[model samples]
Target: MIRPGLTVKLSLLLACIGVIASGATGYYAYRANRNMLVNEAELSLLTSTELLGQRFSTSIDDVGADALVLASLPSTAEVAQSDDGLRRNSAREQLANVYSSFMVHHPEYLQIRLITREHHGLELVRFDRDADGLVRVKGDNLQEKGQFAYVFDTLTFSPGRIYTSPIAVNHEYGTHAAEGKPTLRLGTPVSNAQGAVVGVVVIDIDLEGLFKRLQNDLPSDYRVYLANEWGDFLVHPDASKAFGFDRGRRVLMQDSFSVTKPLFAQVQSEVRVNGLARPKQAAGQVLAFVRRPFGDSEGNRFIVIGLAKPLDDVLSGATLLGNRIVRMVLVFSVLALFLAILFARALTKPLHSLAYAATHLFAGHAMETLPLDRTDEIGLLARCFDRLRREIRLQMDALHTKQRELAHLATHDALTELPNRVLFLEKLERAIEEATQRQEGLAVLFVDLDRFKQINDQFGHAIGDKVLVAVARRLKQVLSSADVVARLGGDEFIVLIEGQRSADGASAIAARVVNALNEELSVDGQSMTVGASIGISQFPDDSGTAEELLLNADAAMYAAKADGRSAYLRYHDVLEARRREQAEQAERARAGEGATAGREAEPTA
Candidate 1:
């Protein structure tokens, strides 16, 4: 019986479509924005790498220039020829001055060391700014044999051209002593006038500074790393004891090997694959890497710079937009449901009213009209219901009238036009109340036809019926207007007299009723005589209630039967006591019979 509303169905469908469209749009926007951010980050990283590479190349060039100037010195040639103390001291002083000037110009460089072309071993000198900014010569017997592998290798392999390599440098020089650490040394081979290698000039730049700069440039949510070709960490932001000399403990190199192993292998390849200048791949994470060579002429060294940004920040706005769209759809659904319910109620209100009105009309009540002002289908239904209600109301009215007539006939007697015993009792209660309020007595007289059953046995029941009906009419003719007479079934009739002065007054009315019933005759060509026994009981004197008064009156009428069946008796205490004595005597006689039977059952001896 329940039908769905059009508005609700449409709204639900629209909400579903809106949610899907919004989710799709949000997903596309998030992907586009994420891709744009990743491209921008890659460009920024490339620019930073190129800038850093230029800085490194320029430092190498400066070191080469200084090395050329030192190699051309006439004092440097004399020191190479002789092992004299004064010549060695002068060469050490000149080298110290050059190193001192280089340190002042490039503060990032820790120290600059110049090695000579002699087996006299190594000379140690430092810039002594405390001593009038001059070069101070130190021990000449200091051995450089074990610490100069990179320098020896450069000279042996590429004899004439400038060579640069990164090497571990000692930290015993002037400013380096205060720096409290060693560094990766950038060493360039010094060449003579004939373009033949003379010595090696080593420049120690702080690798930590480069690492810190790169770390600062990276986004807060991203991680950056610089690693060597061997996949060992040369510089990490959080450099601790674990990463000091234990190359195996480097987290960045291990992660790159595990996550981007293909990219790492491609960087190691001699030829580029896939048209990319540097091979890169993003697998389980979003990562960008660029590899640049960092040494000059001596050997090519790889510095892999990598950056990683998590995807959570990239997709956060998209997720929020999707959630907002879902919420809006839910809100719209609730609003639409509410409006749909209201509209449905408005549409069905007239039908519900018509149903209620039809129920009333079927129950034989007045029909109710419905408002038909609307121009919709509900309005037409209301008009039809109104016509149906009117037709049903007319049929109900005719049926109600017939029911009333039948009810009246069933409860009334045809001869006396008075209420029967059933109705008389009902009226008796009301009369009793009135009499009690008036401080007077009401009376119930039991009028019985003495030997009426014998009269019916002798004269036939049809004639008996006619005699009783005549008796009913004669009683009505004799009784005062204040008295009520009703045929109680068979030949028994009752008279209710209100406002009785006393029991004597009620007995006087009972005498009149007895006389009236004795005169009944003339039915079906025969004249019949029937005597009456009338017994009277006064309310508030004989019994307190209607039922008790009626019972006492009947008992008195029975007493009249014992007296000879043609007179009336007023109920009194003497009659009640005689009836109780007779009942006690009968009970004792029955007990005596029972005792005699018990005695007779004894066994004989």
Candidate 2:
């Protein structure tokens, strides 16, 4: 017969084995579920990204097509044939009509303008409504003679063809605007009936409005970002100042064009590595990235579109099954322990009198009468509980620590030891709500390093990281305890300043920050000067909600960069009008050039 102690030890060992097996199964199932969920999320995001990218491309194409149509208008040709003074007037009327039609049909378009080939000056024919519901026109010339000299020179140098340039802030306009305002200029050679090259027609567009429309297309939980070939954040949903392309007062190409040399090389390898296509049915998790060539040449830049999803969400049901099994095992183990304790108590009672006699005999230094006891289940249970209590106490402490560590790692940034984006945004929303209710002002500023990429490209990322750390130190020193500052990622930082009295008060803080950051930072015995362009938007005044406030602030920040770096700008109505005008001019130029050659040839025939 098994002794009570042996019976108890055997039961404990069996329970431990069962628990361990259950835990292993549960862990495997949890991991599988997590992977599936991640895969699903990534896939969803990827699909959305592709759909959005297609939409964006389609919109751009539409703008181009519309531009082509406007350029072919008889009124545009008449303006081209007329003298300079009459041409300007005719161009104005034609531009107004085009702008009205385009805006009415495609509210995504901001404005339209026409540029002449000879003078290369810009004229503002269409003024779009600003944030405050005011319509404003660009005071610059149509040909961009004095202003947009680069744009004019590029068009003039390459005449009778359509050219697309990066979105740039028109400093001449002096307003804060975001980048990615795609300007499509079509330079058509105005020719006589004999087909001689004469003047050129131009069209410009503001893609910012299109971006806004596209953003609305995305789900609330998902974020849509438009990066240049380079990894710079072009259009981030978060109006956090950390977004935008500013390179030491000059804007760096942050779109797909900004990929690292090595990364680009790898991308090239993937493109040419093999002709083999991806499999139709892949298992587990899959990250699909497609590199499509931009422009009409082999050497054109490639746009990398990636789609990812979590494997866990996809297999949550499987995980639930595992969890239930583990729970059942735990319940059984607890029931067994309780029954063992009751049996142990019942069996020990008979021994209690014997134990008391033995204790008295030991105290008196005399032999005690031995009570004969038979081996039974109750005695075995008492021994089992004794063993379980000892083992459980030993393991519980270590398990708790491990669990806490895991929780910490999930919420904190490994590099900075600070709360990550998830935590920061959570707090930010709460802060915004509290401030809004109190009728206090709150400001969100998105701060981006002027030329952080250049530093990384020139000195390597190690040095670049060092520079970032130093900058972060300075940022912490500048802000108040109440203010929330977070590194969204890379060289971008977001500052949420609460309890402001007015919008100007927030502006003043932004100015102070710009000034503070304007100083030279010494890194690795080399001193480099970088400036910041801050976009400030106040609560209630700029937006009623946190998301809208952030967007307005972000738009204003882009405006600052567009106006000129090392400055700050608040959201204003006039900025939108100017953006529309720029977009319209670029569109007209594209359409006019295509039709000009054909029209000129017809007259000659």
Clashing pairs in 1: none
Provide backbone clash counts, one per model: 0, 86
- lDDT (Cα, tens digit) per residue for candidate 2, span 518-556: 888998998886678877777766777767766777787
Measured against the true structure, the TM-scores of the candidates, in listed sequence, are 0.44, 0.41
TM-score computed on alpha carbons, candidate 2 = 0.41
Model 2: residues with Cα > 4 Å off, grouped in runs? 1-19, 86-95, 121-161, 174-203, 237-244, 247-325, 331-605
Score each candidate by Cα lDDT. Answer: 0.62, 0.56
Stretches > 4 Å off in candidate 1: 3-15, 30-69, 72-78, 81-92, 124-137, 157-160, 166-182, 194-196, 213-222, 241-252, 255-286, 309-605
Worst 10-residue lDDT window for candidate 2 reads 269-278
Top of the candidates by TM-score: 1
